[model samples]
Target: MTAEIGPPKSANPEIVRRYARLLREHGDAFNVTDNQTAIVRMSSFASALICLQEGAEPIMQMTCRDRNRIALQSDLLGASALGVRNVLCLSGDHQTFGNQREAKNVYDIDSTQELQMFKMMRDERRILGDDELEEGPKMFLGAVENPFADPFEFRVARLAKKVSAGADFVQTQAVFDMERFERWMSAARDRGLDRKVHIIAGVVPLKSLGAANYMKKKVPGMIVPDHIIERMRKATDAKSEGIRICVEQIEHLMTIKGVHGVHIMAVNWEEKVPEIVEKANLHPRPPP
Candidate 1:
């Protein structure tokens, strides 16, 4: 799972401890986001290093929103030096969506370029600009895909681009509607993209109906089915109901043709991660 530092992304002592709990108790490794939502906080490299010191593996993120090609390659090498063996490349959310609406969002290289850059650095032993590295970063590279994203029919094709560009694995956005997700997965399988990338399905546990409504309405590239909202509304305990819903999603995800595992996004309800992981039978994670 790609665990958040915070919404804006932080690297405080408390946030580090929370990360430790998630990694040591409930998950295999945690993802360190790169200025999520474009609101500045600690660097993903720093957060990942912190996770490493705490005995947790980190998936370092490098988004095209903040760095140019030079900075991107440099930061990736730095991450490798700090023992971050996994990297997730992404095109960040627009700056207009963040608290700092006026900040310039640099997409000098879109997400696909980010993936290709990481691959070139790792596999070719050279940066995208053709500078050679003595010893390239031997890292497991990843990319993000949101099956719930618009033009859903083209989402699988985009996944194909990621794989062809050298993404070793992929973690999709929070998947609430298994039906739609399966449809996406089917197309991915049909094109053989699933065979090429480790597909980690993302899941978010709905803490309350308010959260559900917010995701349904506010979140872009998200698809939260109305039945889930109705279930949350009728629940005697919304929290417990959320857990059950997450578990249900996990089970359904496991049955899909090419899903390798699940990435549980606990969000604000991070403390409840252990519960969802345990109840969903994801824990006692296999030793690395």
Candidate 2:
């Protein structure tokens, strides 16, 4: 039997409406910013909620760095109430990477724990307060994976654990080494995760030699090969070249069997999403 590939067909009417409006107004694609360390801040969450209310499928990325359980629950509930259904739970970047160097780190719960909490709330119909209603928010829970992590043997197991804990989908760390990623996918399949979860590969276009070098040295678990570095070096105008590279990367990623979609991390270049999507020929596959 052929393995099922592509996003699930379920869609909430509110989510659909939001998606349509975003496309009509801003073009046909969008993603949340990853540069911010604390994604659950009221301002950031409010802005994201507005995007969802406008009919965009805002993938609200929640991090464990800034919020305790109270704050996390408040934001999650708010997101659900606002028609934001998809979530990407993460452990977040260390404080040293952000502008706020003195900010406190809250690993009160890691990504896995957070995933489990969401699942419990959804399944049991309860949160911290008994007065809260039993019917929980609908969410397409997602998690992140780094294929380049050491002790490669643990990667598949870790992915399996996340799925078991209730991750409906996964977005991998930026993939410059497609071969290694492909192998990891194959192993994940052999371990039986391929049938259970959707995988969206992360692709970030190199903006310049400085950017590429910075990611290699500063960013954890991100690797851009020398050839891609060379390509960036040869481009006369780095930004345009980066966009072109992103377009090409998405095109190539979409062709991989068992691949569901591509998550574009354009950083702050949100305007470039639609162009890359159009160039790559990725449309919402009709619900199967």
Candidate 3:
């Protein structure tokens, strides 16, 4: 669920509630944002709690760029107290990339350290400094993996490090280069990571030629192929064609042995997800 507020503040209740309603109606878990792309959006936890009230399961996104270790740990506890179970930990985009470019960056602890802290609280029933908890919070830990990141050879190694640090699952960056993604998946399987973690491939259907171009040229750690861009350029109905491309990608992903699931991130386009899911025949999701 992409709740891009389009420069609006969080006080606009509709921004959160409307997306929450969409998630509930579609029976899809919501992924509320925490200043994604370094833009100041609604607090991820706030959106998550709103979605929870609307009867949708939410995955709160946390980043290390803004909060220190103490704040992170406190927020985790607060999130748990508010009934949040799943979390996606990220190192976060740099502050200079967002509207608040002048704001100081606070990467007091890196993502790996944050992952370890989460693991400590959830698995070992302890937090940083090794204080014991009579009962630990039940959390479904998740992390981000950018297969398109530079030094591609090290991508899998980074993923492995996250898993070792205590990630239960990984939601990768938006994938458009299927060939590259296949190679990455092969590496993941070869390294036996498929057995250790649930890997959810991210898919963001192109809305237009402009969106495709923006992704290819602007987004960091993203890989959009030239052919996809050309196809969008020539297509009369770019939006429909984008959905077709995404469906094809989902179909291909289903055949890959190590792939566990597809995380469709149709930003601010939640309305299109049900169509994509239906076209991909993902209805009546399998039992756990």
> For each candidate, what TM-score against the reference?
0.96, 0.83, 0.94
TM-score: which is higher, 1 or 2? 1
lDDT of each: 0.84, 0.68, 0.83
Q: What digit string (tens of lDDT, one per residue) describes model 1 on residues 10-65? A: 44666776656555656777877777777787778887777788887888888888
Candidate 3, residue 218: the lDDT equals 94
Worst 10 residues of 3 by lDDT: 1-10
User: Whole-model lDDT, candidate 1?
Assistant: 0.84
Residue 183 local lDDT, model 3: 94
Model 2's lDDT to the true fold? Answer: 0.68
In model 2, state the lDDT of residue 48: 55
Candidate 2 lDDT, tens digit per residue, 154-257?
A: 98899999999889988888888778888888898787786799888888867788898887777878777887788888889998888788778777776776
TM-score for model 2? 0.83
Among the numbered candidates, top lDDT falls to 1
Looking at candidate 1, what is the lDDT of residue 208? 92
Global lDDT of model 3: 0.83
> Can you give the lDDT of residue 11 in candidate 2?
29
Cα displacement (angstroms), candidate 3, residue 270, comes to 1.9
